[model samples]
Target: MDGTWLDHSRWPSAGRVLAAVSIMPALALAGWLLAGLPLLLLGWFRPLPMLLFGGALAVALCVYGARLEREDDAADATVWHVAATCGIAAASAVFNGIFHSEQLVIRRDPATYAQYAVWLADHGSLPIPYGTAAFGGPDPALVPSSVGVYDYGGAIVPQFMPGAPIVQAIGHWLGGVSGLLLVPPVLGGLAVLTVAGVVARLVGARWAPLAALAFAVALPVLYTSRTTFSEIPSLILIFGGIALALDTRARPRAAALAGLVFGLAVLVRIDGLRDVLPVLAYAGLLIALRRRQGRGERYARMGLPLLGGLAVGVGLGFLAAYSLARPYLSYLSDSVLPLLAICAVVLAATVAGAVLGPRIIPAGWKAMRGGRAARWLPGLAAGLVVLVTLGLAARPWVQTVHRVAKAEGDVLNAKFIVMTQLANGLPPDPSRLYYENSLYWVIWYVGVPVVVLATLAAAVLARRMALGRGFVWLLPLAIIGWTTVTTLWRPAITPDHPFASRRLVPVIVPGLILLAVWGLRWMWARARQAGYGPRVQRSLLAAGGALVLLPAVVTSIGTAFSPIERGESAQVAKLCEALPRDASVLIVERVTGERFTQVVRGMCRLPVAQVRPSGEAGAAAGANADINLAAPADVTRLAGRIRSAGRSPVVLAAQQAQLAPYGPATQVVKLRTRQDERSLVDPPNGTWSLTIDVWMAVPPTS
Candidate 1:
């Protein structure tokens, strides 16, 4: 094999070792996405088939990867580095496991994702059934859908893409709810390992552990990993794709696999489509310029496979979106159309360039690449990065970001922002987006030092790439820099801590930290070249690592030790068990229906519906609730209809008194848990006490 970047044997030992650890989990996730969707369509998504099909696909990938070889291959691994990476992976799992959140309540996205997985694990189907037969028929007062699940043509469809829940369903299949909760943490561990793998490949082997530790201890990593957030899995795929692409320098077959992994990120999170645009451009450029990937291997082996694999992965995502998640896709049409247009433009331009560049003055391309202007580009690009960052940092002082609510969720988000403002003692401003302070969000977690170092590293990478160097840093720099600036500029989520922070978890935070660690290493090497004493060099390195680790750890420390949404799973279990067998449950109160319609239907595996809000709950207990509820006459008619249909009718409510109008209320679920803090102006501090109660009654059939 040519001794180029593609030859894995030449990479530092830690890269090879970390690669082995990081690759499997990512591939496993991709395999699930590949295999699970079709089976879901067929209503055959049981554990045994999923295990057999998805597992076989993953094994095939590993076997194919194992065949990569070279005549000059040298030992490319060290036992200790392998041990450290494995240890990092294990520690992340254990830490997240110990602090795992039980977010089963249907309040936010995490709970929504959890419920989605719960349905998949239990039923192995899409477009959840309304089970309206038990209620005699559908009534206007009784709707099939609730929060996080949409009702289209009387079918209960879940919100968001199916990728995260599929992984979580596997966890549930293995060990029930406990296993499902464990999935995110395990993915988190895998993500930590993958981040280390990237650092080993791009930075240096010695910096791998520090990178792993820094990323592992950060707030977003812990927060996302402790719950069923899509970001962790997306993180795994993004970095894992990069690692595979780097391996393609030796194993040409791995190029398609890398594309598959990168493309699957769209399935995990829709925003991932935006995150991977650079790779698409880069691959196109490689083919357009006829760059050598290996000895005698050019002409789009990497480009074609990368694009093909991406199409398959992205095609599956779109298929699922149009078929199973149409409501979710429709809800996102405003953003989705523009994103698709951008992707089309990028793809068209890439094709145009590849077709035209060779035919239209090929030698001129080289001249420009090697020209005097190219020599000066590094400095100019580096300065631009610096200037842009400084400008963004100063942006909040001069301008405040605002957006009008365009949808139902956006309206709620605006109210949430107003509520948070009052909590923080600020004047009401519903349209305030808080995006201008996105740079400060970085500083709040990683501190000024890591951000500074990350900037330095980014500048250096741009400079080196300008001079036709820094191949290793190119993709990392592009993906990270592009995603960082774009996300911070328009986070596009509710501007509350822990909620808005999820935007930073997958790419922005970890990528910046990885770059900062690499920057620290560059400085150390420069110091040695400057003839500094070993002690001085060591001191500088230690301080830099501390700056990287300490602030992040301190920022996350309080929330790290305290897991929120405790006792939720147990409460769900109790509520499900307490319902009478063959019961057609109907919720009278609004909050109860919104929070438990999906939970009761999915987790309890029972037929459930909610009556519209009465608008007569004048007491404080029900006064603050949202959602539409029905009058007592309407609820009574629905229950009577259920009774006449040969089903026992039960009424559910948040308070015992809310059920008093129908029958004697029995408290089924009494839960007290801790909730993540919702800080708007400041960083998240700690958890808040959260209490929920569920009451049930079997209405008299007379």
Candidate 2:
């Protein structure tokens, strides 16, 4: 190893490095909070604070960076890496927009997110009007039957965290409705670039572009970039934070910056906090171990600022949520205060343990004699393996207990179970879908060999960690492992092709890419050490890269040109255009109503209600139901009520049978839609054509 490998002086300037990484994102976050929080608290949106604070902070950072000394080491290589990453990201974004962009809102969650962004752009604050006047009152049925809208205190508020909406709002402000479509792809590109930077830090710059390419072209990345999913931005922050943390040894401020970024990630998605728990542990371990090695002062100087910055970031995140997203925060009301208190206690406990526990505990003192107990480590490992094998042999009984426990809380697990049922139906053996779909999606994308190579890379990294070296690399491994387990345990219930694969994009795909790259690099080094020529090493590496990437590239080519769903049909658009702004729309089928309520409300700016059959509005039923669709009398009564409220009542039904009792249809619209035909356990094929009748009837003249 060269001495320059450990020397900070050979690296680029801290300012340049920060510019290449986190500074812009941090500023943008600060600016967003500045502009957004005040609007939420004051009930008015103002752009001045955002511009002033963000502009001033950016200038200050630039000025400070200018004062720092500069170092040069192959500037062209850095530029190429940056350009390559940016190009890959841009191409991926374009590809995503072309194919995966949802024309009409199909999924409830994305629709809600889009609406929240629209609300933010227009109202610039919370308590988005339920637009109840269109529905004639503050009835629960007036609420859009979307997944992320919460009915709280007689008002409709978005249930998601504020981070992604705030980002989407930028797009809404810039380009109106079209801008919302543009935001995710841009963020997706940024995520790709950020992951490249992370790979460069963890592995080497030479491999960074390839890692970025692998991630940018993966099915998960391509699919997610086309929609306004929060995962994209969360990924940017997480990987960027990790990359920034790697530079902390050279630039102490980098640690604080990394902490702030990670903290913001939690604000974007609460699960991000769980993902970063390993980082906290890693930091604490560094502090404790360094102190025992008589490097206490240096470690404290760096670690304390990092911890403090993390607290600052977390504090700001909660503050933003409390001020701007109070209604959404209400969902977590029961646990928030307790969770905060617990976090504070844990932080205090960890700091104390790092500082004093090492001195007080006998195990800490005995660590100086570590060589004596090291020999027993192999025997202990063998015994643990034997015990684990025995446990696996008795797994059936253990699984039964686990199954019973899961069933006991079946309500909470209902969504995932429903997804499995949707994908595979009520089979004699049902657990296979969950496990099989999880593996199948991965295999479908990168091929089985790449999966094996990634596994090998993970094993190698694990071995390195076991040897008590390269602890820094453990963060990515921990994130990948955690996300993979959680996703497979309960993949999201989306009817999209690839079968719940979207959930794995942020961590799993990136992790696997990094692992594959590592594996290739390791192989090349081994080949060279074995006296192979440069040409052989290059050929081997190229072939490995191609094998790892070919499946995804081929799949993407096929799927990218043929989308599953088109935007709103021309006929539906015409109906929306013809419908009066004051019209009240009612959907007959409970399921279809819940799905399309947001589309009607958002696209047509009309209040829509769903009618459920009596006894169907159970505890788990959606919050938007006005009348029973099954009863002709109830439908007639709701129509009368709509007339009494001085609004035309329009009914939409999936079948002619549904509309027969109401009256003759006003018009029939044909919609070619994608239906989830998973009961047969076949891969979802092309769109299905369905005919829907729109009906309008006059109130009785009595």
Candidate 3:
């Protein structure tokens, strides 16, 4: 080896690690081919251990890569990071498969997004049952079910910003829902790498790789990046926009790219728009400042390229959203509000600029030199703008939220209670392994420590040195503002709020890591100033290491124990396997459950079809048709539906244990795992009652 090559001894080799990450996608595809295609061909069979084993192997590869560095060549770090991210991303996909799926059979909100992707890709719009289906089969699709338009059955599916869904749809067109599920992480990984590149450019080489690793392993990003969620996509746009703006040299193409990304980011999460408002305002102020300096043409030149980029991104976003939403225009009132408000704000800002251009330039100049007040004035203005925009956007959203809250009262309460406790400093419950529960507590418990430390470091750095002072603070401030607003406004408990910890995934994770790095560097500089002894420095390093690693260690343990339980899919698959396929079943749960049933029917071609509750339910129960009870009331109604059918169809009860009537007739099939799930049946009794309480499922009568 040449002398220039970095050492490569202790581990298998860089080539091996890089190969490990690249090989994951191939392994995942193989699993799908083996498990998924086989199930599709051979009447549905359980593929649990196969899926889990594949996922576990992928995760192991990622974790192994995280620790190994056979070679120390700085240039090779990017390859390693990419490999780790890709490998981890594939692992996450496998894990998601073990838990929830997008098909109607799995029937959950996360799966609902997947189903929606399939529907859109196939039909260019949401499925009819999505809007028209009622909560539980006993109810018509048009009935006022609590699950709302997006709920699959268990968790509330997030309303993805246009970019993510469109991209997901494209993936679906290629390889179905599984393909769509893979897209978010891929895009997210690319974004993370881009941010690392930006950091390498801005900060010195010493901190960038560490910062990149920190972001990659961040619990919030890891969890969300594992799913087909929108937060990561929005983050990509926001960071890409910032990177575009920070290029310093006025390249129109770069500015245009920045604008395009900003436009796309806003479409993914409107909150992202709020986060970047200050950046956009800064861009304007920069232009105005340049003009005042007698660089009017140069200012226009800078503005034009960015504007062009914005146009391209927004145009694409609108086309995507319009295509997806065309069939459900009635759903528009809330969806379009943000876009309208944005238009209004741009117009108003343009007018204000025209009116105050001369006066504001001087004030802006004063604010630039202005002390503490001036230092914060820009942020304050941006905050006010965001608040105002939210208010305007709220008009169409209020009714939708109220409906979702009332319908999903239990889930809403649970989400709210958990989120509130997390924000207030309560430890997470290991038993509650739902995505919302794990994410909410994890964000508060893990995120707060990282953010607080990073914020303090940036504050110190800004004060102590003049080099890249405000610029260094810009990304952190945008992140803080966005994180703060999201934590407060889009609380886990909020009705219609997509309940995933992944929503917090952002470029800020790396930014914070860099801040922590700066803090260490700062302490060392101070140690030198004080003429501290070697022992003192060692002690400081030890203390710092403890502070950083303690919570991380705790969180890692928590994550291991708190694997998410996608109850709906697991239960449904169990039901289908145990029940007779030819039997007609009236499956009922919450509104979310009803949606799940419909989706499963679409995917699995199940004989169950949810119809509006009729007085004749008692009559239909006895006719060899299965009466599957999912919700609370379904228990009392189950026996009647059976008696009405004339013959006892096997009954499946969810949640409740007691089988009071037709005692000998009831045969129970309970789900045995760490998860708390049970199903009781009425075997011999001709007409029996069954309560359906699992996440999502459609059963046959055996």
Candidate 4:
């Protein structure tokens, strides 16, 4: 149990490393089967049952893993620490994945993602057909709904980056519909492992597990990881990329791999470009500084490989987008060629600057290096001044952005404005949800002292970065800062619960946790220097750690144990099971219809279509449709059309009133519904006892 055993010099053997890696997936598989098998056997592979079973099993595995790690010897503790971290992450993901609403979380975003995955599983190609008749011609029933599908050149395509779908498709291929739900959790677990590895590199191995544990239960991390969201995958790649980049000095291939991974990140989410910007800047800085090496030699050793890998990765990304997502580009009224050209130009310019600019600015570089404070302080001051001046100058542009967002029916922005007005009783109030709520949420989980500690850690890290002691860590810090500012500046359009806080998970939570750990380590080091005995120092550290982690632990308990709102009502599942697979369904209400269409097509494996009320086609279709069942002629024609298609006609209405004209529905299903706006922090609102009526009618005497 020597302290030296925990040193970086004591690397684990390859067998141990492989064992550590293998244990996670094995545990994950065990957890998944334990959660899924009971429901599978009981014929209740639905949301509620799966969530309960999966959550319990995951929790048990995490607890047991932690206990086992606690009992391990220091000589082989590193492997156990890694296994425990991965186990906790995997367990959390399994629970979250199961606990996530069985239905798509956000109708537009996730539904499209699920559909894309489903299509990939089935067809394994581009240009997903909206329906059987989608490619033949324009059918009003087949028109792209806002719920993630887009109309593109007489074809229907998913309106999203394909990275997440491609990942989810693997799940679909493996486990069918339920498998898609597993993708995010698995990626989530990997992301946690990556974060732990990064922390171990930047800080120490001892701190890695704590950081990972903090992140595993973080509200944003837990919530987002459960859903079929793109952010999880993007985070995994970005974190992994950064971790590899940090190791570039020792392992140059790691830099190449990092660049390739980042390139794939952009392929997953266009916004990932923002995250990688700092890495690019850092690479340029490395090239320009040429630390302890000849300029051309340094470029060849570090710059060339990184750039080449970036070029290759980006080129592959463009190729994938153009080849696999052509329909999506067409829908956006854009072409991939222009984007590819632009990226190529950027890459070329970067290389050219790295190669030529250093020579041109040799004297400037020397001068800047000669006086650190004189150079940096002025530059920093000027940058701040420019930022302020730009903020003042761009007021009109900012207003225009808000105006445009509002016009585009941004619900979050509108809600923010309303909330601001209600809170302050003022006109033209900018939304401060991100700024205000971010701090509150952080405190809600990690407590106020940790926030202070994190701030102090940030200052310390900034100093270390300024001294060039830990320059590699700066890129990730920059990403954290940039994303935090931008996310708070413009939060996603979502209810305050999951979405608002969820966006901050990838960077903010991890950044804060890293800083807190650094602060704790700093305090412990100071305590040791002040002549505290080993026993006293250990006690103080343990007490301090408890204080730092207690709030988050308590909050996590409440969150983890809370009942998840079931996405699909039992009645809906019953209806799906009861209805014939080939039956043609005519949904009277637009919102209900579009939402259910995905469920029917993807989960139930049925063909479903919607019919808007005559004059209400465009407007009513946008929101909820008010179907006029009193218009017998319209109902008769729709029923006749359904019957003509060689399938039984089944009509579904959200309201009983909408079904009266059908002369007594064959079945009426009462459903418990809640307002879609929800958050993990808040308890569920009271359910609305709504009824869905289903009618089986003969062809209207055609």
- The best candidate by lDDT is 1
Candidate 2: give the clashing pairs: 103-567
lDDT of each: 0.83, 0.60, 0.44, 0.57
Candidate 3 structure quality by residue, lDDT tens digits, 156-270: 2224443454445556655665566566556546555545544443443344454455565555555555455666666655654554454423343446645655665555554
lDDT assessment of candidate 1: 0.83
Which of candidates 3 and 4 reaches a greater lDDT?
Answer: 4
Lowest lDDT block of 10, candidate 3: 676-685
Stronger candidate by TM-score (1 vs 3): 1
What is candidate 3's TM-score against the reference? 0.59
Instruction: Please state every model's RMSD to the true fold in angstroms.
Output: 4.3, 6.7, 12.2, 9.1
Clashing pairs in 1: 6-249, 6-250, 612-629, 612-630, 613-628, 613-629, 613-630
Whose TM-score is higher: candidate 2's or candidate 3's? Answer: 2
Number of the top-ranking candidate, with TM-score as the measure: 1
Ranking by lDDT: 1, 2, 4, 3
The segments of candidate 1 whose C-alpha lies over 4 angstroms from its true place after superposition are 1-15, 66-77, 291-301, 359-372, 614-629
Candidate 1: tens digits of C-alpha lDDT, residues 389-424 = 898899999999998987887898899889989877
Better model by TM-score: candidate 2 vs candidate 4 = 2
Task: Kindly report which residue stretches of model 3 are placed more than 4 angstroms away from their true locations once superposed.
Answer: 1-108, 121-162, 169-195, 248-250, 294-301, 311-347, 362-444, 447-449, 458-476, 479-500, 507-511, 522-546, 566-595, 605-609, 614-702
Off-target runs (Cα >4 Å) in candidate 4 are 1-11, 14-77, 94-100, 104-108, 130-146, 289-292, 295-300, 316-352, 360-362, 372-408, 411-441, 567-573, 615-635, 667-701
**What's the residue-level lDDT of 239 in candidate 1?**
89
TM-score (all chains, Cα) for each model = 0.94, 0.79, 0.59, 0.74
Residues 61-167, candidate 2: write the lDDT tens digits: 43443333123211224656666766776787777666655434434456667776766666667765565565455443333444555556656666677777777
Clashing pairs for model 4 are 497-679
